[model samples]
Target: MPHPPVLIAGAGPSGLVLALILLKNGVPVRIIDKERTHRIGSRGAGLHPRTLELYAMLGVLDDILNNAGKIVPTASYDFGELVPKSTMLLLKYHEATPDVPHANTAALNQDRHEEILRAHLAKLSCTVELGAELRSFEQSADSVVARIVKTAEDGTQSEETATFDWLVGTDGAHSVVRKQLGLSFLGETRTETIFALGDIKVEEGLDPNFWHMWNVGPKMILMRPHGVTSTMFNFMLKGRSEHLMNKTLTSDEFAEEFYSLTDRRDVKFGEAAWMSNYRPNIRMVDKMHQGRVFVAGDAAHCHSPAGGQGLNSSVQDSGNLGWKLALVHKGLTPTDLLDTYNEERLRVIAHMLGLTTALLDRNDRGVGEPGKKEFKMHQHGDAMRMLSVNYRGSSIISQAAGAAGAESDPYAEAAGAPVQAAYRAPDAPELVPAGTQGAATRLFEVFSVSAHTVLVFGGDTDARAPVVDALARFPPGIVHAVLLLGQEHAPPSDAPRFGAVFEDRAGHAYRGYGADADALTVVVVRPDGVVGVVASNAEAVEQYFRRILIAV
Candidate 1:
């Protein structure tokens, strides 16, 4: 009998990423898209640091950084010049952020970004079947069966059939996969058609390092330097006309507008690589998962690109879903864990929506310091809190915790009793926890790989000695056991289960898992490598495995 395929719909970023992650974890997957070929149009143009880190962990960040456009930084304030401003405003405002190593964002269009991802997918010995379109699906007790039709590059069409244990809808905003499941996209489409985007060549004189924006009037224009070229720029115009939303801007029309907007007829619009009109809308699917199928990226939730959150949030959505789905496939976790993706992601999306709205309407009018902070809080949130997306408050988290004792201690910095001396490297940030080698070249190398890491946090070998004894048997097939200890400590290399002792200065592993200076901390990470359980004591630690892994 043939093994059930993990069928994926769509070959965009989300679908491709899900395929890459699952394949890396030893799961076989097949991806199909209706498009006859990859998109030549420049779609999304922003790549946040977190997404880059995920790609890096997948061993593909170098490809993106080397091939894509280098992102130039710009500062914005109401009625101020759109040219680059002092970094002090950004740095000071984001003072409380944990020092995660990633670009805040870079300017790489969707075409180039997906090209890099596709290259990586091909390197994995798998390829997407372009021109393949999903027709419908039926789910049985154990698997989902899907019907697909492939159109040959030579203009011939044929049918292909496949069955899978699971299916994911990454087919974008108008996803057929999402509709086939009968899920409702519960949100409102924007009433105003205020934004239009296209790519054009810049004039002979312009700073290549600066993002140019004109925000002084009702119509706002945002232009960014494209690629390594000084004479090309991508522009977005905001205003409404009856035909603005539907009419395709002709090359002459686009060129005329460029000169009018900049008040320079000398500026010419060269051949446009791609052009499209989009209206900002805030929409999210009421349900992310149903039966054995799931939705992600634009198929799950989409919000206004007020702060360029659409693609970043979608990437995050898929990243969260990919790890959980991988765990269930490996039999290390149950279906219940899937519910957490919606719980955690919905809350994050809500926060982002609020921020995008505020940034769009920043008047500095009736807005006091509190209002500004509220708006900017989301920006800071993106920089500071965005790095450590947690799975707590998730349905599967409690199940994953599985009776880890929760005796609250007032003196505790961690979840439980306090430890006298925990591992603290000389260079680890005092504020951001121990073991973060902030932004070093090897930073992602040490912390970003996908692994189910078990962090035993304690300096005193005696207190943590029990955990060392408990987890001393399993190898990499089960979990990656990491004993986080301070210096002035040593252990036998031949110890049974404890594989590697990762110190503080090595990377941000300790802080990433939300560790504290507790006497004994045992954290069980899922196969996608997100933290699952943080056991403060031995009884709680033993109960975790018994409930989730040991018991039926």
Candidate 2:
């Protein structure tokens, strides 16, 4: 097609998700990968609850949940004797409330996750160009020109140059994009920690419903069920530096060591599907963007796999950047809006790096203390679920005068409370307008990645008219107005005259938003599902949009 709007140099989860979201929003995207074929291993296996919610918004949650496995209890063994089991159920799945629909972590192989994303990408009429490696790129004031080498099956290579409005590098840790930008991937690489990981079919006797772990002194072996098959598992082994350093283990060797460590002669190993030697590195760039070029996913930050934060953080980075990039490209928002991608994501990555690092340190310390060595699934608090991550202090998020006192720090919250400005917009059930006697629809169903959602809450349509009129001035698709009325309010006779008008039949929508029914409140939900601004009047709402949206 004509020069695409965005060129994504990597087809991993981050790049794929970024391209998919942009494409779904009608932004042209060209995605490329160095590898000729899609990956095959269960590399990153943990999907946080926050990521699941994002997937839902992207229209891929059903595909993911259908193909992924549930997080199972982890069982620890010492010389064939069973120890206390550590389950993620510490925050049980049943605890999921209406506001937070996905409360539990999910287990899915990264390769399979990418497959689901690829399928969705296909629906958008976009296919990742394989065997196309980004050799180098240069960015000017208005565009980026990139040189890519395309390798054919016959081993012939051809180089081509293309220009795009923007460039994003989602390539992994050794990101050429970051290096070429002269940005430092600053951090430490623990020479002491090395792991041999593999995906292999296992013999009978081992329960696939539980993650099995064995810790013996400086050596440890973990076997987790792989994909939907109980007979296959993703295995990881950590041992003395000498044992893992620059070493590759064969299938027999891996199986032999597994039996020796666990002392379980009954367990057998089949063919190996994938294997690799890895060194844990905790590193990140000082910033995520340089001019028109940006780096995301493993390119922006990488850490120990202790908590499986690498993939989750990367996916979120794209989620945070996609909408901003789309709006800017469409000329609906100012170019400065793109700056918030770096401002918002850099802090989140820093916090995530610290979290994963701490977990790594704990794992290291536990090695010496046998009592603590018993593998227990980390008890993930709200932080691990990523529900607590916010942009409360962001420049774009404007709150009412009194509401500004809620919290200046994005990471701080008052234990349990309704969603706040600069925080994620929680989901709520909305009644099908007053006249229609039907089931309630979710708040997210009405939200889109291409527009801002204006939620006017109160029983009085007359009071909400100004806010509706303020939104009406903007382009039709740029702003979506939804009227959420109290139970007592009558549904408007002419529903089509107004935008989507729903009744807060159960008060869940009002309570979830923490809005007082007695007072009028307008909640501006950004394309990314974060509450951009909370205003008491239409004037404040107009001013908020003027600051970001170009047409306003």
**CA lDDT of every candidate:** 0.61, 0.80
**Candidate 2: lDDT of 188?**
95
Q: Against the hidden true structure, what lDDT does model 1 obtain?
A: 0.61
Candidate 1 lDDT score at position 48: 64
Instruction: Candidate 2: give the clashing pairs.
Output: none
lDDT of candidate 1 over 119-144, digit per residue (tens): 88888888888999988888886799
Model 1 spans with C-alpha error above 4 angstroms: 1-4, 68-99, 203-205, 240-245, 361-385, 398-450, 459-462, 472-476, 493-496, 502-518, 526-529, 544-552
RMSD, each candidate, Å? 6.4, 2.7
- How far residue 358's Cα lies from its native spot in candidate 2, in Å, is 0.5
Q: After superposition, how far is residue 28 of candidate 1 from its true place, in Å?
A: 0.5
What number of clashing residue pairs does each candidate have, in the order they appear?
Answer: 5, 0
Question: In candidate 1, which residue pairs get closer than 3 Å at backbone N, Cα or C atoms, i.e. clash?
Answer: 202-231, 423-486, 435-504, 472-496, 472-497
Residue 243 lDDT (model 2): 51
For candidate 2, write residues 66-130 as lDDT tens digits. 88878876666676654433333323454777688887888888998999999899888899999
> Candidate 2, which segments miss by more than 4 Å at Cα?
82-94, 240-244, 367-377, 400-411, 414-417, 493-497
